[model samples]
Target chain A: MSRVQAIELVYLFCAVCFIVALKGLSSPRSARLGNIIGAVGMTVAVGATFATPGLHRIGLIVVALVIGTAVGVPAARAVKMTAVPQMVAAFNGVGGGAAALVSLAEFDRGHASFGTAAAVLFSTLVGAVSFTGSAITFAKLQELMTGRPIVLPRQREINAALAVTALALVVWGLSDRSVTAAVLLALVAGVLGVLFVLPVGGADVPVVISLLNSFTGLAVAATGAALRTTLLIVAGTLVGASGTLLTRMMSQAMGRPLSSTLFGALTATASAAAAGPDDGADRSVRTGTVDDVAVLLAYAHRVVVVPGYGLAVAQAQHTIRELADLLESRGVEVVYGIHPVAGRMPGHMNVLLAEANVPYEQLREMDDVNPQFPLTDVVLVVGANDVVNPAARDSPGSPIYGMPILNVDEAKAVVFLKRSMRPGFAGIDNALLYDPKTTMLFGDAKDTLTSLVSAVKTA
Target chain B: MTETTLGLFTIFVLSVFVGFEVISKVSSVLHTPLMSGANAIHGVILIGSIVILGTGHGAVQGVLGFVAVVLATVNAVGGFVVTDRMLEMFKGRARK
Candidate 1:
């Protein structure tokens, strides 16, 4: 077979592998295998491309590969899971940027018809935005920048001007005879990227990630079109579509408008932080120990566990599952209240819980499990904070106001596992901790839960 | 590098980085949010497909464009619905 045909076949294989890998990733049991399959497919695809013509400049290819491998290998080996988001952000941004670079380079090499020009402009816009936006996201995740919203006065006006200018640049680039305009537009887009992401509070990270993923996919499709490659078109389109859907889902989960998130409205300003104690009607000053939490759970008919970022930090899902198992042994009903936006990603809590061997049926969504909280003997909150905070419902001035929170605060008794009084990603204090019936178990979630499990096992 | 080579490089690099994510267990607190956030980035597919449709000209392109638009819309709608359902969990309180 000709090299072109071989490359096409490789692309087909890569596409198939991506599909399989994605399917595998849908469940925890097969996620590892899925990742491996995807990797293999990608490897095959790359090998096939090497067979393509013009790409036979062996020296350049070898050097690029060596440099990429050298930089990529150690970075991958060293990053922590907590830093995973930043890594994902940086890598995803690079993918979009690469696609944009390919499209630009190809445009420079000839594909500059009016239609192609528009496509290039659009792709560049999307890719540039994704690249810089994701970089900011990485910084936030890395704690290089505070995850709190950074809203300036008259922020909307500034955003509006940036959007208008970017659009104008695109129109100008499409009509003008110069490439300089496109370069200028790219710079504007980079600035817009930082501006867009900086104001979004940490709570909206899932939406941001999804949005960036969409950009990467879209950029790839554009790259495909620029290269006149049908497979790139298909693969890129699929990824873009899936990514878009995921973003909308994340936005809905958070009950925030997509436009606002993109435009930077989620930031909690200094004024809002200072007004915390004025709204005291539903204030909770509650506190408790593992023994106190145990007593409440021992006689209770049903207990629901709400796991959050805290649980992920404590690496305590297994222990939490063990505690739940013990509770089940004592005839206490156990269910998990999984918030869709519970962790940094969609279905994050589910993945973690499933890893710990938590039963699928017992793990309920927020809607399915919210009503059951009233009858719950105890609500065990493991390593979660903002997700369960009452401020979302009770305080309008609160940073998390209007955002839905887990209903654990409404439980007959609430037990919180925390390291200290530190705020959540939004960097705001939780009022639920101070509630009368609430108890704080201050320690590592895993260790504390282990202790609680042993106490219950012996009791 | 060939397109195929680049694709392979992407996969290996991503997997190694992704693997580190699973092992380092750093910033465990952000995992849930990060996952959801990453999931959201998947929406680029919608935007990508839409732009492709926008560029199509012939009858074949028209059909492809229509398909892309439909798929993108469905993705956007379905994703939001699932997300909303998840958010409701954080509402209200229970009296024990």
Candidate 2:
């Protein structure tokens, strides 16, 4: 085969590697191996591209690659595990920006085939949106900006009108072959991307990040179509598919429709909470200390630990692991009950616990773990609230009603490690907190877990 | 439409199905890694940026190509590294 044919073969090889890599990533046993395979595929594809005969401005390309690696490697390496979501958002944003810029360059290279303008237009707009949208997501996740939803007056109507305007701009760009129109369209879409995510907050932020990741994938695919590059098309489409499926699964896990999740949902639920169940503060809770919780844990035949976002925010994974190990040493069976949306992103709790060296077999998914709650002698809830709240299934007026939650209340006894009496993400009271069988330990999770470990040893 | 466009379109459509099928059954345990891995895969746009830079000319091309290549590199490089970092903890613990 000719050199060009050889390169095409390599691209084909890279595509296959990607498919296998994705397959490896989703299953527990092969996830790490899958990631390594993916990196190899990327290296091979990049190496082949660099070797493309007559590649020009070699110095500049080398410099750009060097600069990017310098910036990207350290940030990825040095980032705290709790901050991986934002780091992913950061990388995703730059990818979108690059795709947008590449397509724009292609358009100016006189490849603005008026016939293929739609494809070009699509890649550019979506790419720009992904870039800007991912930026805001990064900021929110990083706490560089507020995590609360920033709703404007009639944001729905205004965003709808902007959508119409953006569509019109796409039509204009296509018909006139106007780079000017295309550039303008990108600007409007960038604003739309920002406005799009600004009104989504709380647990919804992670879902928005997943959706924007999908947007980036689609943008890259459109870039592929615009440039007629099969590698771009295939790789981009694959990511688009992964992100779309992840977003859907995350929404399903949360038991909310994708649309409402994005557009500042739970307003009705918020109002419902406001109207009546304002009794969380007044009702007395059965508060306890480290010794009480430790004794409860030390003797239990089976204990299930339900970790929440608060456990992550407090960086208490290691502490929790220590506590679990201590319990298991005494012949108690300890397993974690992980809610699907537990740690800001889908499957996040698993990663956090893995960092603490908790074995995957012991980290049970919601469905498999939920049923075991009743058989559990003690349910130790660490920095978690809503996921264990019986109100989701029992209280219709509750904001989180109908949402799937862990059956923590079914255990013979429940112990809560909380920072305060504050309601959970849905902003409603947890009736479970006041249940006669439940006991609350008010403190930071890590500190409380530390105390529990010592208390258990003594008790 | 050109035969080339039609063929590419065919590839694109088939890919969508393949993509969905590959990831649909993934347990929630690997969601983060799958996403991080896929995020890195899309970084293959680095190839597109490079080709554009190698052939295109002028001030506009230079500026756009430079930025595009850099951003794509970060996306690809950072994406893969972070994913590996996440997987490292998983592997390290599992081994012992």
In terms of lDDT, which candidate is strongest?
2
Compared with the true structure, all predictions reach lDDT values of 0.62, 0.83
lDDT of 2 by residue, A293-344 (tens): 7756766678999998889999999999998998878778899999998767
C-alpha lDDT of candidate 2 relative to the true structure: 0.83
Q: Show model 2 residue runs off by greater than 4 Å.
A: A265-459
**Segments of candidate 1 deviating more than 4 angstroms:** A252-459, B1-96
Lowest-scoring 10 consecutive residues by lDDT in candidate 1 chain A?
A273-282
Query: A309-398, model 1: which lDDT tens digit per residue?
Result: 889988898898888888887777889999888878889999999999999999998888888787887888877788887889899899
Could you give the CAPRI-style class of model 2? medium
Identify the CAPRI category of the predicted complex in candidate 1: incorrect
Q: Write the per-residue lDDT of candidate 2 for residues B1-96, one digit (tens) a residue.
A: 889988999999999998898887664435676788889889998988988888788989888988898999999999999998877755523223
